[model samples]
Target: MILIRLESKGPIFYYSYRVGMGYKIFKFYKFRSMHTDADQMVEQLKHLNQYANDEAQTIKTKPLTRSIIAYSNHDHILVKDDELFEESEYEQFKALEDKKAFVKINNDPRITRVGKFIRNTSIDELPQLFNILIGDMSLVGNRPLPLYEAEKLTTDKTVGRFLAPAGLTGLWQVTERGKAGMSAESRCDLDIEYALKHNFWMDMKILFKTPLAALQHENV
Candidate 1:
């Protein structure tokens, strides 16, 4: 069994994870990165996320036929409705449509100011070192998923990702780091691949590459 405990250090409060049963559980520590009621907020936000997912699926199925028109009071107009957009325009449109599925919100009101800073610098994950030190996790392995995310991967095709220990950093996060519009399926494939092929040398390679990966804007 895995146990999560809340503890306070000075002005900061964080969670500690323990994995085991009976008298043998080991404790792991981390700094808090979210609102204190984040867990409760998840349920409230579930329908909104599901709605976003459905919207994304709908956008994927529909062909891009919508056109935009711009009006100018001057003698000439820069763009016309029927004119075809450049490749970059199409990419931008797709990205905009897909934004709902991946982006938390325009500014993400749920995230505290401190939360944003810690997340951007990867400091939010610093406490997980205790887990690594205690053997509950590794420096390089499949990232631990929240219960909601884990449930979606229970299918036979995706379950292989769980064969390895959870990590502080992993394959997809490094390889796909600044690339936009990655699907959940793609992430699962990378996790499963890492689980199947992970070894001491590969782990060391990942550990070495992690700092550069973390520097990228899209650490998710």
Candidate 2:
């Protein structure tokens, strides 16, 4: 089974999303995506009466809410209708998505002044190089995704076939990373298809093509 874990030390946190293949768990590193107090905040919120009531409610309005409900419906189907979340946790995710998308707009309102630069230059992905160096990812392969996209794609069965080592760049990144709003999950499947069919010469071509792709300045 694939295993992913997150941990924190002092004011900083570390995350590693790993894949279990050939009976070992390889740690894939990434920049911290949450605040140091994220867990504490979540636990504190859970203890509130208002929070409990909110958790029991259904999502019927808001774009983020609808998207989450749509995501959940798909995840349920993929899991053979098993409930992977409590109503509150799902709704909370809707809020997080909204926050993610809001600041993620062409000029995001939620991003700090520094975040824009980090995101645009792909500096945020630097941490994943550790994953590459360690063999959790290769120089060319599919992108790993957040859980939402993984859930949606599982229904296709093709997703499982793409579970080889992760990559920092792929066909999807070259084609659409900045040109389109291709979700990370969608990119994963496409990258998988490419990796499955790839050879050494083709991999070399992709590596050479990547710098040109990066120069396009489409992030703005």
Candidate 3:
């Protein structure tokens, strides 16, 4: 907290409405790991969102709505049948596709020095223990999503992830954290895998792997 204070002027905890299980919106918390103006800076950096064009999503610098980011600690899929979306929703999804559904900047300029330390060490996620206790999240499950990112993932294939609780660590965190080819669809696949097949043993395995996964090797 002191490091965050010393490095910048803002609330030490960053809170935003994150889409959770069953598409529920909840206040997600994290240590503030970026400059105060980070949210406003999103649009300017949209061109860097990374995509292999698995389906041709233009990679741009990208926008992360939640402040503390390391693959978001958090960050998707598209609807197959266009008929499912209402006209307004379809238009928004198109804009979102153009905006890029997933974004993780390689060397984001908005992060503060202390922010960088907390993020790399996964210390920024400590605040979420409260969410776990209060039932907004859990110790093991899929990570929650920011509204912008969640809006693009309601298709039948990807929406299954919401069956499990949101968590601090999950399948993707342990398995795909730093994989260069980890696409948005692949992340959702892991999440869905966990949702459909998660059990006590699996959760324990994930919990065991978390410490290792949390020790990330790159800057985001």
Candidate 4:
């Protein structure tokens, strides 16, 4: 039984499912940073982004490399290095990039007052511990993504391995979840890297880093 709240203001949206093992359908949680109107907004801005690209000079760059250029003009706010999570409470967020699944707006209009606080402090992630206890998640791993993003990874060859288990906090969360800078896909790519090189000691390292990440706070 995956639990979800469309109104969540955290960094990732919480979702859960039962993958056998005699376990009940457990609840998975994540911060919801995407705008409630994200889908429509992206669709509306798609052609604009295309036009912008077509009218501009093409500069070839490496894939997944960090950039500071704001990509939100088209509502597809690509995670760059400028979106550092500075909530002070979640200082570890500094290491991560501030991005959403689809439209990664810097100052998303959907965020509520309480939602902002929860997102910044990462308090919104508290409920996931239950998932950890129930074996739905581990202390470390890659953060799960939406079905849409997962579909894009079909050719990555490493997607199945990354999705092997649930993670309380993962390489992506602890390392790439900054308050506001960094592209969403770039962070996901980093997660793929971690999954490829994962080990027990690496997992432990992430576990140790999670608390510190949570305890940090930035400018709300």
Best by TM-score: 3
Once fitted onto the true fold, the runs of candidate 3 whose alpha carbons sit more than 4 angstroms away are 52-99
Q: Best candidate, lDDT-wise? A: 3
Write one digit per residue (lDDT tens) for candidate 2, span 1-220: 0111123233222464443322234555544434345334433433231212233344443233344666665442211144345445565655533322111123323333333444566655677777777667677666664333334444343455345545677676677766645443454456557757767786787788777565534323
2 versus 4: better lDDT goes to? 4
- Evaluate all candidate structures by whole-model CA lDDT and list the values in order: 0.58, 0.48, 0.79, 0.50
Per-residue lDDT tens digits of candidate 4, residues 68-151? Answer: 324322323334464422133232232221222323334445555556677677776777777777677676766554443344
Best first by TM-score, ranked: 3, 1, 4, 2
C-alpha RMSD between model 1 and the true structure: 12.6
RMSD of 4: 14.1
Candidate number with the higher TM-score (3 or 4): 3
RMSD of each: 12.6, 11.6, 11.4, 14.1
TM-score of each candidate? 0.63, 0.52, 0.79, 0.53
The lDDT, on a scale of 0 to 1, for candidate 3 is 0.79
lDDT at 183, model 1: 59
Which model, 1 or 2, shows the larger lDDT?
A: 1
- lDDT string, candidate 3, 1-220, tens digits: 9889987999999998998889989999999999989888878876565642434442232333333333443313223433222334444546457336667776788988888888888999999999999999999999998887788777777789889889999999999896676677778889999999999999999999999899775667
Which parts of model 1 are misplaced by more than 4 Å?
Answer: 1-11, 16-29, 47-106, 216-220
Worst 10 residues of 1 by lDDT: 1-10
User: Whose TM-score is higher: candidate 1's or candidate 3's?
Assistant: 3
